[model samples]
Target chain A: MNNHVILDVQNLKKYFQVGKNLTLKAVDDVSFQLHEGETLGLVGESGCGKTTCGRTCLGLYSRTDGKVLYKGQDVHLMKGAEKFAFKKEAQMIFQDPYASLNPRMTVSDIVAEGIDIHKLAANKKERDEKIFHYLNLVGLNKEHANRFVHEFSGGQRQRIGIARALAVEPKFMVLDEPISALDVSIQAQIVNLLIKLQKEMGLTYLFVAHDLSMVKHISDRVAVMYLGSMVEITTSEELYENPLHPYTKALLSAIPIPDPDVELQREQTRIKLEGDVPSPINPAPGCRFKGRCKYAKAICSEQTPQLKDMGNGHCVACHLYNQ
Target chain B: MSKLLEVKNLRVSYHTYAGEVQSVRGVTFDVEEGEAIAIVGESGCGKSVTAKSIMGLIKTPPGEIKAGSEILYRGENILNYDKKQMSHYRGGESAIIFQDALAALNPTMTVGKQIVENLMMHRKTIMVDGKEVKLTKRLAMQEAVKMLKMVGIPNAEQRAKQYPHEYSGGMRQRAMIAIAFACQPKLLIADEPTTALDVTIQAQIMDLIKDLQKQLNTSVILITHDLGVVANVAKRIVVMYSGNIVERGNARDIFYHPKHPYTCALLEAVPRLDLKNKQELASIEGTPPDLLAPPKGCPFSTRCKYCMEICCEQAPAATDFGDGHEAACWLHHPLAPKDDVPFKTEVRHE
Candidate 1:
């Protein structure tokens, strides 16, 4: 990976107001950086703020606080032409392929929507050519150009979503659970296609997914999230091999290996986390994961810990790691 | 262990706008008492149809279980059973838990009442104070709460009194499991039980299922696409592709010494959590064939890398590898080249 920082998020926070005096802190005090051609995976369970954080970084959701900088320019502060340029430079692939693509629009029209917006093509023939080019790049044939989005299967629809994002020629992409909806046999195909495309296009990616194995497979670095807080961030290998935080350890251990022999061996050493994730709305003052954390202490509910670097660029936010 | 359930030559088809969709085509398997078996495959592979057929949940007019299909439950052919016998067979002898607990459960009834009604229908007596007594409404309510607590749900009393929507995803699933096991049925078919749950929760549920199977000594047929989950809970696995049994073996046999191309490709396809280094995933080349006018040969032949000329024309019969392990593939034929089978020489067997 290059030393150039493509995207930098600083102390980002996004909140939603539900009741008269209640505030839902969806993405609270989360920060990370994406290097050129590097894929940073944001992983957490469902209802965690990983999706919200990705959206805030892409300027899809306006941040309630902090700044999201793209190439040294603030994404949320961009104006008319600058905003348009940022949109062209950054694209998002949604989680659900079935719901994301418009049913009425043909595959060619869905893909060319971005190309036409950026005025990448001059004539109708050029537009058609650009459309088919992206479709082919994602493993679809030109014959699929005229077909409706509903006609294709889940994997094909995801490919179309990828093609739509790539048609914009974006330097940065935020893939939000792009392969979660696809089947087991089909997820690898999409993951491989994404890796191949990143290599060919030199694109930086912010891959947000709940599937930890795939996240580790596709990411250079990974950030683990709790309710609304980032519990750990480190190189993918280090995070998987030597997780520090209690929540991170539990999360990693919870993923069942495909091998029966390994699963048999791991059963004894697995960390069984107690209770469910607590409510994120008006969450307690202490650590967000203290309710489910096995190693939580008295001070854990009083003061929230910030991310601290241990070594080798590994950061853990917990009282146990604090000392 | 005796055979608790046996499905022989199971054939199911659905009527669509175009033609009949041959869903479960000649699937055959048996589950021994107290044993947990898994039916694994991708979408449109008829794993769910097989599960539904076992539960007698298939609609007859649009969907039909063809003649000669037999789902024998303890020497009794359930296919010939009328409505009264079918209802008696369901829940009393066998029960199924669905993927979406929210949808499967009744919206109007309290969780406790649903369990109570299920218990009242299937069972008449409860073990109280080490004595068998007629089940009263109050006793059934307490039994329902007991079942809820057994499935690891906390505050069982209050949670049981609440509606289905009031409970969380994991809790609702726990409640569903409670109801399924309330009757202490001999057979339990969990259709993708944890597919909608998160990873950590999925592991928890799988563990709970394993524990319950041991406690109740109930036979289980787990239907899911997740191979990792299959590894954890299933003793034996039956792999399906396009409504056909592609491979069947013990968990170790399928994972360590897979012979079928589809099975090998599937194992290579998943990005395992045990991965030490970055590696490109090996994927099957094409999508599964359409089942409307299903192919005559191996359905996986269209995408199999080792597909031979014979594979396209004829379906290969099951080749046994001893110890209840078998795979349907032409490459396993004695005349076929032996060296070309990549998964044939895995290190674990030696």
Candidate 2:
């Protein structure tokens, strides 16, 4: 990996044996790279393996196959002290702050938990200073250090989560729908805080969310996932302006514009998919979206499409652009 | 156009051990017949409380409806209605769709059974050609299946037998819509129905609600924090802030050209897909004031970017801006002294 590429995931596959004969392919052959100081947005519906992929990348869930390359080395191959060091370099900010944090611990102890585990702090005074520093970094005051998680609001609790993630001073962070559980007003504050911290710390982020508007705002590049595969990946502006994949178009069109006059004139006709998303346990041989895809053809059902570059770093996994 | 529901100076408070926490403060808005009105605001803005107030669903003890509260459903004071009268109104003339599908639905009961129970309760008898006929449980079940089909649930008959947990988030929402419309209520109050759902599912649910509203001619009160969801579905918009109707106007008027500062701040706060360049997403600075002892003047004075001394000193009364557009802010109030600072629309790009 080059200096531009902070973390590179290649053909990552994670599967689980659900029963006697069935194998659930959670993340199948997923490949993406997070560039230094850039936010890469990962967007998909629920049960699409986006969460699983994030956890697998973080080493929280052991990968069934493939490699996670961080800073030019295979993450799984690292051993002993090197593997422990890698843990400090890559951290995650989870979706639900209420569930992610330890309810029993105070705010300071929660932020200091990682520091204590890694033995980063020199002494008790240094650890206390570090904890206060991180809490302030995420816009929390020193007084919040003594407060319990329950005392804080949803937004403040999320801020604490962010502060905990930042305490380790990780170069790359995986934000798993951080703002999905937050209120709209509070969401803006958190998103803005994340952007500020990213610039200040020169940090790289893999921001995963289902909100398109928010994804567009924060992401330098975006990777759109469906079922268990990545359908498209491109720069945020390019993806929004000149989408190549049919699914991308459908997703973009689905976003409700906040104006009634425009909405009235605009055709709100959704490409109504007949059935719910199929089970990931035993996915079909063809495109995962074949059943719901309006442009699906006979070939779509017979063969799985591969992600092919369409020039200017825009990649799509649909046969329609495969000429 | 005749008003279907009119909420006048509705105040709801939660009697916590700490104190009486006022949730909804002197909120007033009217929903016309066959019109879809969206109440858009952040959490704790009294959006849900307003909806609960209209439905007569506010739980007492912890939650208390203040003395001045007046909810007029078809020009009748619903707050004064007895239990029997209210029962006739609840789920019969008005129905509510809550946010959480799992919590809203009974896990043990199948979706079909729930819909059938509601249909039987609200519409036990139907009129056909001036003759009334009673509906059996079997007929109610069949009608429930049909209702599911109407909400665009494929394989409705088969899926209806499955419990709520068996259905996907999108399907459960559709089932909820089916139950809500099973009664054929004149007014449907959907409280953040799509907020808990994903974007794609959110779209589907919004479309479903719109389609059903058109078909049934049911006036809808869409309660949501998402401004995007409100833009398309609602004919009119009511913006609530700290339990007050800060702004009310046509959806287009509010989105395109907002008069109130709070409304403008809210619009700016939302992250838009079309925006290019990276700029800080706008956020309202302070937390909402404690409702028990709300600020004397404008509730939003502390957070308002263009706040003046008058904003903190005296409460601003609702000022009509003609064309049925109204806003409660010192900026628009004529008697209030004008500030030197002019309203600025500095477009921040990222």
Candidate 3:
């Protein structure tokens, strides 16, 4: 969307020790760049480390290796005042609205939490005005200011969460499946609000979700991850129209289109992925998806494939596409 | 076609401190033999309540099914069935599988044992040499493993010996399906069976359900809020809103020619994958109405764009669109405004 790079993630890896001899590679060898004022969608199935990647990029989780740079400043290396400024500049909107916000606190206080932490407002009068402004921005009224989290519905609570993130006036946001917990009718409402807010504020987004349709609609570029590794990254149109990776094709085929006619045509051509995603703990070498891949050969299980650009800025990591 | 199950004027309400919440108000539909129909609606729209009412899971202390309600199973009214008769009808004649497979399954019992228990309750005896004998546990366990393998769970013997937590989300759902079909019931109610799994796993489970339905020839009623999911699986679709059936038709009819504004709005609200460019989603403006004192007219009138004055005054009766398709909306009335639909809906006759 822009020439300026807002966030650059380089070979980021985040691991956890599950047992005495087991290590879970949640985010391994994942790298991407988020341009200024652009929404980059990170999509994968559950437990594929999309959420872990987003959190690691936001410096929420300590990385095991590599660096996350926000506007050329390393996010993990920053300490004291620099880290506080980075927090104010980049906010995270969590997945569960019911758990993200404090249930006992009023809506105004919940929205003002970021404002208070960043000292964006000086006095009580200024804080109230800022809170009301953000409330109205996210389509809430003044009457909801004093109401607790339990009094609102799931959609309204998600709006409250968005308002809290907007209160800090962040230039970038990491939305971790913000609409997954919401109902279908309510999901479009939040997506529309996010689109409008990004247009009005010129905010960059690192949208992490498993919903491919929503990702295709809202993102300028899309990245596909599998078993804690990015398999493909390209423009949204190119990625959806011509997916080069085998896992990406399978993931796209799995999504059920809401029309019977389309489903009738797709049923025969659909790729049925067998079994579940392999456990990420102490994973084997070579391609992580080789176990389920149809075109996996001897070379796929022997060596890991790196992301290779296939002209026009489209990158894919797969042994089948090796040239 | 014979009707496998008929729900007539089913009125279910919950008495709370505030008022009586009409969870399912006079819902009526029929599941023909060997047919697959989906009940699609948003959360709090009473789809789950209707399923629960049919299953007789409503607790009477705070919940009540009003008089004049009838749930006919194989031409008999099950609402009047006694405890022993009801228990016999529950797993023996009809079965239900829930959304959360982990919670619906027992944590302490092995997967095989659960299936064995269901089989023992429903299928107590088998005929051998023209004589009925009591089913042994060993025989039931063998049948349970066979049922597990039938649902596509590999290594069935070893997996059956493990508990529910040991199985993954899709596998647990498969085990649940195995138990539900073990009795060979006439009707199966799958309530959001794949809602907890991801898209890939969801596709696998949906395929499994489709295969099993054909194999057992059992009528299925799928309840879920996602319209995208029901398209491929359900033969007919029932669109519900605020405890009322706004529209019901064959899958193609509903997708091509949606009569009610709520159904049309739901179709346009979800973003489509086939569309290439970024487009504005036509989302509904407001939330569903509170069911405590339900609206007198159409429940979707508050959010409908073509809301006539008469719509707020009284509820519209079901207007038939032929071929067993019907929708309850004022727009279809002859005296109402003509050509009021904002979107051009194609009506293709096959």
Candidate 4:
């Protein structure tokens, strides 16, 4: 991990109108920074707006407020050549392999889509060479190039997706739950492939996933989201070992340990959250997790807690540490 | 404990245009009166087929349960049951819950109505107001509210009246569990029940299921691909691969002293949060075998690090270690060389 910040997201918000008067707060006041060659994991439950945050950061969805600075330039304000260069500098690997790629397109065309759009290759041979190079980089061979997308398995299709993302030679990539849809054995394979590629290409990643163990394994830092708001952010080790927020503690404790011995010997109190997450539409001005938190007090419902920096760069947005 | 359900020599095949796809082959297992047995494997390993066969849920013509298979439930062969008898056994004696609660539930009707219908189908009479009465819709609705509250659904009276689409994901799953357990079935089969929920919600649902199982003494057969879930909830685990049972053991034995190479690879592949040192996950080399024309030998032979000549020549028999732990691998054979431990990928240095 380097000190150079590749992407700086400040107070980003994305809202959707569900009805005539309702506003669904998808990504509200989320902020983070992705350093060069560093993997920053964004973790939350299904409706926690982690994916929306990632999409908003990558300019896939226009931000309702705040700014997304990609190397000190506002992504929302870029135009013409600057926008094209930004597209080349940033890419995304989608979550679903089955739905992301077109079944009619061959693997070669899919991998070369970015290359063709950017016209990185001077001749047909150079394009073919680049396609084969990315395929090999993602553990696929030149033989797999001519085959259609439907002919490949889930893991193979994901590799094709990676190859497509890498074909652009992007400096920053947003991988939105890249391995969540895969099987366990295949998940490790994909993770290893990503690690190998990151090391070789010096790519920075904003990996969004629901799997905590996988996030801890691959990320230098992690941020926990709940109901469209970031609850905690810190180094992966410190976040896992000494989580500050009650929601993070509950989430970490809820993860089932694979070892029987550890599971059997675990005597810690299970922080069972009481109710489901409150609806994000017209949410109250308070902690989003207050309804389910065990230690919530009167002040928690009166005002929203801000993400405050503790020592050693650990940050938490909870009323427990307000003093 | 007496056996509640026993499946013997169970072979199921699907007929397609290409050939007969052997989805499940000679699967044998038994669930004790109150035991929780988990059948764990990746997709297409036939764990779901086995679970569906137990409930007589497999669709024939395209799929068929082969001859000489016996599915004995409570000392009676349910495989030969007629339609009416099968229906009676399905919800009254045994029930299955699915992962996707919305898909499994009736969307048009209120959740309470669904539970009441199930209860009325399985139950004949209920005691109401200190008198024995024929189970009426009103009485059944009362019971449904009780069931809803039992599953930890808050505001059960109001929530029970809403349709399935109105409830959240975790709540819908809880409602499904309430419906499944409404009949008080002797056996419950949960097919990846928590796979669709978040971790915290998954933990809550698992705890609820365990509590209900203990309270009702209902035998459970949990089919999942997650070994971590199995370790935490299940007592006995049967690891399957390409329609074959590769290993069966108690949770402790399976996790700590795995015998099969596939099991070892699976254990090593999972990233553990308890470990102090972070290391790269060691994954198995290839995908599961294609069931259309599965290998004549061991199904995992193609990816086994300990693959030998005989592994491809013939299928290995299940070698029983003590305490009901068994593994089907050439390494466990008596004639195989000793000191040949199952190999795992080396931990990464950097």
Chain B TM-score by candidate, in order shown: 0.97, 0.94, 0.96, 0.96
Per-residue lDDT tens digits for candidate 4, residues A203-315, read: 99999999999999999999999999999999999999999999999998889988877776662566776667778898988999988898999999998999999999999
- The residue pairs found clashing in candidate 2 are B277-B350, B278-B350, B279-B350
lDDT (10s digit) by residue, model 2, range B1-350: 89999888888999988898889989888999999999998888889988998999889878999998789999999999998899889988999999998899999999999999898887878654578778889878888998899998888889889999998888888999999899899999999998877776787788889988998899999999888898888988999998888889888778876878888878888887656766888897767887878899999999988888999988887776666777777776545446543342222122
Q: Judging by TM-score, tell me the better candidate of 2 and 3.
A: 3
Question: In model 1, where do residues sit more than 4 Å from their true spots?
Answer: B345-350
For residues B38-119, write the lDDT of model 4, one tens digit per residue: 9999888999999999999999989999999999998889988999999999999999999889999999999999999998
Query: What tens-digit string does per-residue lDDT give for candidate 1 at A1-323?
Result: 88999999999999999998899999999988899999999999888999999999988899999989999999999999999999999999999999999999999999999888899999999999898889899999999999998789999999999999999899999999999898988998999999999999999999999999999999999999998889999999999899998888888899988898899899999998766677789998998888887788999999999999997789999999776
Give the Cα error of residue A139 in candidate 4, in Å: 1.4
Between prediction 1 and prediction 4, the one with superior DockQ is: 1
| Ranking of predictions according to lDDT | 3, 1, 4, 2
Model 4 stretches with alpha carbons more than 4 Å out: B129-131, B343-350
Q: Could you tell me which residue pairs clash in candidate 4?
A: none
List native contact recovery per candidate, as a fraction of 1: 0.70, 0.73, 0.78, 0.70
Worst 10 residues of 3 chain B by lDDT: B341-350
lDDT agreement with native, every candidate: 0.91, 0.87, 0.92, 0.91
What shift in Å separates residue B125 of candidate 1 from its native position after superposition?
Answer: 1.9
Model 1 over residues B281-348: C-alpha lDDT tens digits? 99876788999988878899899888889999999998888888889888878778777676663223
Model 4, position A123, has a per-residue lDDT of: 98
